[model samples]
Target: MAWNEPGGGNNKGPKDPWGGGDQGPPDLDEALQKLQEKLGGIFGGKSGSGGSGGGGGPAFSAPLLGVLALGAAVVWGLMGFYQIDEQERAVVLRFGKYLETVQPGLQWNPPLVDEVIKVNTTKVRAASFREIMLTQDENIVEVNMSVQYVINDPDKFVLKVRDPEISLQHAAQSALRHVVGDTGMDLVLTEGRAKIASDVQTRLQEYLNLYETGILVSKVNVDDSKPPSQVQAAFDDVIKAREDEERVKNEAQAYANGIVPEARGGAQRQIEEANAYKEQVIANAQGEADRFSKLLAEYRKAPEVTRERLYLDAIQNVYGNTSKVMVDVEGGNNMMYLPLDKLAEQSQQRAVRAPSLDSNTLREITNMVTEQLRRDAAASGSTSRRGGR
Candidate 1:
């Protein structure tokens, strides 16, 4: 049953499947030689030759070695297929020279021929720069700022500069220093922060363009700006003083706005009143002059009669305004005068003191006024009779 079992044969080694004469699990050398010759027949190489030239051990399996090498090559090629993220771009270089850029996706390249560099084109990157800078006002301040950017051209980013990010950092610092240096310290430290940041952004973009850094600046922010620690208190005081100054100026302007209009209105009112007064005075003078001219023309026709009429009219006007009445009788030697204003004043005083008047006192005063009037009338009649004679 067994090839090497001993009992049934007479001077025989073992049963031989290939008609071998002897066997104890066939000779190890002869089996290897047969395998080498068979391999030579298949590949057309001298299979008579072993793996290590002239070796007698079983030839190393050629087909198995070829299978292992093929597996290794497949793995290496698979390793070249890498994935690029949505925010990134893949710049491909072949044989150390520019080839092409790839979009975001799974991509492949020849394992040894191509090199890929992934650049983030949509990710916003930030660089912070801080430096002690001199301001246009000749004061020193610490300016801390940040710049946000993105890679716009991945090829230029990788090939144009040896280290684009480091160059960006330097450019940011230079731009910040230049902007701060051109701005006043008060502005840099306070109200002008946004302006300084904008100026820095513009300058940084220019620098990046000049250097072909392929960076697009998105925004620039002024993080912190301040005077040195030794002068911070003084700067704070100065800031407060400036605020107070601004407040005072605003208040003064408001006051001027309020008072100026009112003053102008008052002045306009005064001017209008003066103009009315001037018009009224001129009209009155013109009317008086015209009346005088008319009266002069009438007087030229009859001199004596007009003179007498004018004298009586003057006396009438004067007497109408007076508190007392006076009569000059042509035939009488004395003038008769009635102090009616004084009598009225006395009556008013009495009425104010007593609130009532006595009827007997009013009767006695009336009798005296009547007697004086009768005597003046008799004298006027006597004068008239003598003139008729």
Candidate 2:
């Protein structure tokens, strides 16, 4: 039965394992002394000498505590082994103080004595949010944006900030607000989203660097921006109106481009025509002046002959254009006239109508008329000579 149960074994009084003599438990000091000796013998230590100077309890437990401590240290060291991927970096700290940053690979550090923080240096991380903010035009706009980043320095990322991602989130919000607040509502909701995103990225990176967050911002994207639902229709109408205005301006510019060149060409053509007319007038005037100058030189050599030649030339020119000629005899009261053009016309008509009028007969008739004119001129010249004598 049980060691403390009564009336169970051999019909004897209950036995005490501690060697009690009066059916009660043994003395605390004496039992403890015996137990210490037994444990000392088991651990290969000498038992107490039963004197004041010999104690085996401390000696027996010393080696056991050392072995336990060594085992704990070995477990702690094993716990420190960590594998880092190719894209990660590790930051090590010893005794709560900054140590060295380790590259990606298998790494180990003493547990409880050194701290290790692993960060993915080449992996891009993303943070995104949607918020409402006021614009420069005092209009409220809802902005949806995302920020992409990577850990540039693992040491700074782990050590310089209490929470790097939280800090990045706050910095991103601040930068987005600053950019949106400085822009007008039309730009925020329309074509200026790219510019705003670029500005937010630049400002956010600056803030992260200043705070030593070690977050390198890869890109910032303004996904969507618009007025609240209550004013969305009105904003759409405004955008359409602006687009129409731009289209009208472009059409007017195209029309002007088409018409302006044609008008300029017409004007240039008129100018060229005027210049050609001016050159023609100048050439005619110069030719007339040169002819008059040469005639004046010939007149200086023989005044009377030049005067008579000029008169005859004028008469010849006048007669050459007419069909009739008038001749006045010097001493006779009669004037002679000849219709030579009428005669030539009658002869050509007769030659066409009558087959009896040959070319030879027409030629002989013309020779007779020429002889009579020559004789009349000779008679007039002889009469003039007699009158002069």
Candidate 3:
């Protein structure tokens, strides 16, 4: 029989056999009522009252309470232990005071007593700043820059300053402005941007170190540095003019490089030509002098024959241009038709007299005279025939 079923208890059995006399069965309600009265009296409450005001209400009460306490403890322990990622660091604070720092992986702290703030110390942090300042030359210029950093010391990061990020930003701005103010505009725009970034980074690091912020600056980059937009056009014009000047200078140098060598080569060629002409002239003059000396020696050996040969050569040189007739003018008007006066003038200029005639000279002169008469007779015959016609 089941425990909750009706008449399922020990009273359901037959009446006791040991008692042969009339032993009646006990009343089930009376038995239950006396048992309830005894239990109620033991717990210091009224019998048959089903209220929670009675004490010692159920069995295993202490054990249940113990089990509940154990569960609560387990939950609290679970809440105390936490894990930090590889890129994070935990800053523990005990009762509003710094306690210790925890590295990555599973960590434990007392619950409700200690607070852990996990900061990504390994993550690279970046900040940008911009400003305008007067240079050493009293020109105002604007500079924009960025800085990348990481937290290397968690203790100093949590304890040193109220807000490390804000402090670092301010420090960076102050350093940049200070550096820009100390330099000139030309340097800032051209060669000094790198130097400026370096200087600002150095100053920022110094300030951060002084403040114990534990931020390590990794890189400083100069984004843009220039004159203000209002004067930007004027600055551009200046830069353009400078570039134009450089280009013009380079072009002039290129032209010189091209032309100078050609000019030099031409000059050298002319000089060589002149030198060759001088050498030819010198050689011709030397040859003429040697020939004249040889002629003078030959002339001294035979004066008459040399004079005759020279006269013949002179006559050939003078009369080589045209036909000419030579006549003796000692007899007056021997050849009236011929121009004797002009012939005499030419002979005086030549400084040579006609040869005197002897027997042999006379025969040669007679032959020359006979040939001239025959040529004159033929010319007169042709003229007479043309005139008759």
Clashes of 3: 0
Which residue pairs collide, candidate 1?
36-47, 40-47
Q: Which ranges in model 2 have alpha carbons more than 4 Å from their true place?
A: 1-22, 25-79, 95-97, 295-389
Model 2 Cα displacement at 57 (Å)?
A: 11
- Across 74-135, the per-residue lDDT of candidate 2 in tens digits comes to 89889989888898788888998889988878888878888887888988899998989999
TM-score of 3: 0.54
Residue pairs of candidate 2 with colliding backbone atoms = none
Highest lDDT among the candidates is held by which one? Answer: 2
RMSD for all candidates, in order, please.
10.3, 9.4, 17.6
Pairs clashing within candidate 3: none
lDDT of 1 by residue, 1-389 (tens): 56545546463665665655454565566666777777766855454344432554333467767987999999999989999999989999999999999999899998888999899899999888878978888999988888889999998999999998899999999988888888887788778999988888899999999999899999999999999999989988998999999999999999999999999999999999999999999999999999889889889998898899899999889988999887666565667787889989988998899868589987998999789788877877688778779
TM-score of each: 0.68, 0.62, 0.54
Higher-lDDT candidate of 1 and 2: 2
Per-model CA lDDT versus the true structure: 0.85, 0.86, 0.81
Between 1 and 3, whose TM-score is larger? 1
